[model samples]
Target: MVCLRERMKMGKRSEWVAFCFLCFSLSLQTIQGYKESETARTLKLEQGDAHEVHCSRERSKAAWKIIEEYLMPFVEEERYQISRRCRLHSDNDLYRDQEQHKIHVGVNEWQCGYCRKRFYGENYLDQHFDNRHYDLLNVSHSRCLADICGALHCDLVMDSVPRKTKCNPAAAAKNQHLCESLADTCFPVNGGPSAGRLHEFFLRQFCDAHTCTGGRKPFSRGHRKTRSIFYLFASILTLMLLALFYIFIYMHRRGMKGGTVELKRISKSVQKKKPS
Candidate 1:
């Protein structure tokens, strides 16, 4: 019985030893994993800047064609201010002539799309348009067509299809993702002409305003300030016209009143006097 008891105690001790060994192995594995993770993190940090990759790529012609096909429609309608954000408003515009007016271009001459009037190089066409074709540019709102198409930032998703992509603001997750992707892709700090200067210019000009940078509004605060001034001017002009109308009416009524008093005095004199 004593031997049986000793054997049972030995068995219990062996089981306890096994449990302790198993727990020690688990703890050692956990510690090793934590140390490995720290080492990996330190190596990553030592590798230098995370976004040090300068953009050396240029978009293909097929990509540009896709962009043109998808975006040109919304750009034409009511946004002559399409320059720089959507694209530059220059001689290179695909459908520049079709804007409210038809533009005619010659070897060294630039003609007004609205009136066919001619101008010299660099066009100054926008100023001419704003001054003369003012009616076409004016709208209830000056928001970007991205407010409709949502393609301004999603040029990659836009280029996914060979021909064109539908301009749906609801393209979500995919639509909004490009803004951050483009900061690196479009024009990184290290980006230069070899990375594509024209391409860089295009991306910088177009994406800067459309991306999350510009409060996501195409029209800057300057547009708002100018719009407010325009409204103020219009209000003042309207008030002036109304005031002039009231003054004219008052003058006419006063003249009639004066004439009526004089007539009454003449009639009273005649009545008091003889037939002569």
Candidate 2:
């Protein structure tokens, strides 16, 4: 009977030991799993940060190249490197626009804006840019310098994305002055009344972009909207002017066509003799 009781005690102690071992094993596994999850989260965050940095570098790389190679050589001011208003028209001497212009499409035909070459609909125009102007840009990093291309510069090529329009006037004054001066000096006043109007338009465009009017940035919505409004206004003004011109012509011709009554005048001596 004593041996039987001893066996029962041994069995109970063994069972208790097994239960404690199982609990310890489970707790260790839980700790390891939690640590692994935390490490995985840390790694993911590091990767995301690295990816963002890489993307930013890639985005600005092409813009830096443009600044150094194309713009900086003749620029008088170091600060104007990133400016949209300055040095835009001056860059034309270097064929800058032709190097980076967009493709134009017409009915059943595609034309390369850069080269002025025509292509059939069987091929894509995007492919043409890749082949011709690929060195001018990085297709993967698109929003390189949308806000900084001034005077219709990169209007079609880089204007695909809208730049943040909230310009700071105080910070932007120097560049604005550059643009205004370029307009006043470059465009000829003696050319005609049309030339005067063109100068005024450029002056307004360059300076007005620097101001925030009524707490709202001027949404040019790209050059397309600006050009459309200009054309519409000009068309309406032309029609009105033509109507007025025709009305004046019609009035002059009608007066000329009107019949006139004529009576013969008699001399004083003849009148005296005849009447008497």
Candidate 3:
């Protein structure tokens, strides 16, 4: 009986040891996997930056097809086609004339695809689209698109795809998992690309590449102007306060002198009036 009890205790001890070893191995594997993923993401970012620089250098001379080929792997197919079209329309006068004839009745008019509304200009169309069609168009896909592009270290191409009647069920189902995986591998927990970040990135790139009317300025000119105005107003206010302070001091001194003079005059009168 005593020998059997001792063997059972030994068996339990061995099982506990095995469990701990298994847990330790899993933790080590997880750590290594995380490190490898981080390294890969860093490499991808470096490569993307190099690609962007090359694109910028060749942007003036390179054909749309060549640019598309270079960017195709990094962006979605729909986005690539839209970007290609936009480039062609902007660069080729013939293409622009043809598109304008087909799409615009006037020099500064465009039709909205969703509501068939006529807008006076491209900016108006853009604003209308954002206000009226943004939710109906993007829905759930925007988040997935942003996360995927972020993970791939690519720019998010906007206004590329048409509005969908319904959200993509498959994409919706997998979006959470994809976001989590991307966060773990490509971005920090707080730094992952959301819809706003993707929009910001697109706007920055657009401003850098094109010269659209009223587009965002590269140097934060508005912010600088605001700061300058604030400083000017503050300086004026300080000067005004200093002037008021000096006037108050001058008036107080004058009042004191007047009071002293009046006292001297009264004393002189009293002395003259006294019997001498």
Model number with the top lDDT: 2
lDDT of 3 at 85: 26
Error of 2 at 267 (Å): 90
Query: Which regions of candidate 1 fall more than 4 Å away from where they truly are?
Result: 1-93, 96-149, 153-170, 181-248, 267-276
The better-scoring model by TM-score among 1 and 3 is 1
Q: Give the number of the best model, judged by TM-score.
A: 2
- C-alpha positional error of residue 22 in candidate 3 after TM-score superposition, expressed in Å: 1.7
- Give the C-alpha miss distance for residue 250 in model 1, angstroms: 3.5
Candidate 1 vs candidate 3, lDDT winner: 1
Candidate closer to the true structure by lDDT (higher is better), 2 or 3 = 2
lDDT of 3 by residue, 146-196 (tens): 224322213222324644344344543354344344323322334334423
Give the distance in Å from residue 262's predicted Cα in candidate 2 to where it truly belongs: 81
**What is candidate 1's lDDT per residue for 16-80, written digit by digit as tens?**
99999999999999999999999999887865443232211122222333345433333333232
Q: List candidate 3 segments past 4 Å from native.
A: 54-276
The candidate, 1 or 2, that scores higher on TM-score is 2
Q: Rank by TM-score, descending?
A: 2, 1, 3
RMSD of 3: 24.6
Q: TM per model?
A: 0.27, 0.30, 0.23
**RMSD list, candidates in order:** 22.8, 17.8, 24.6
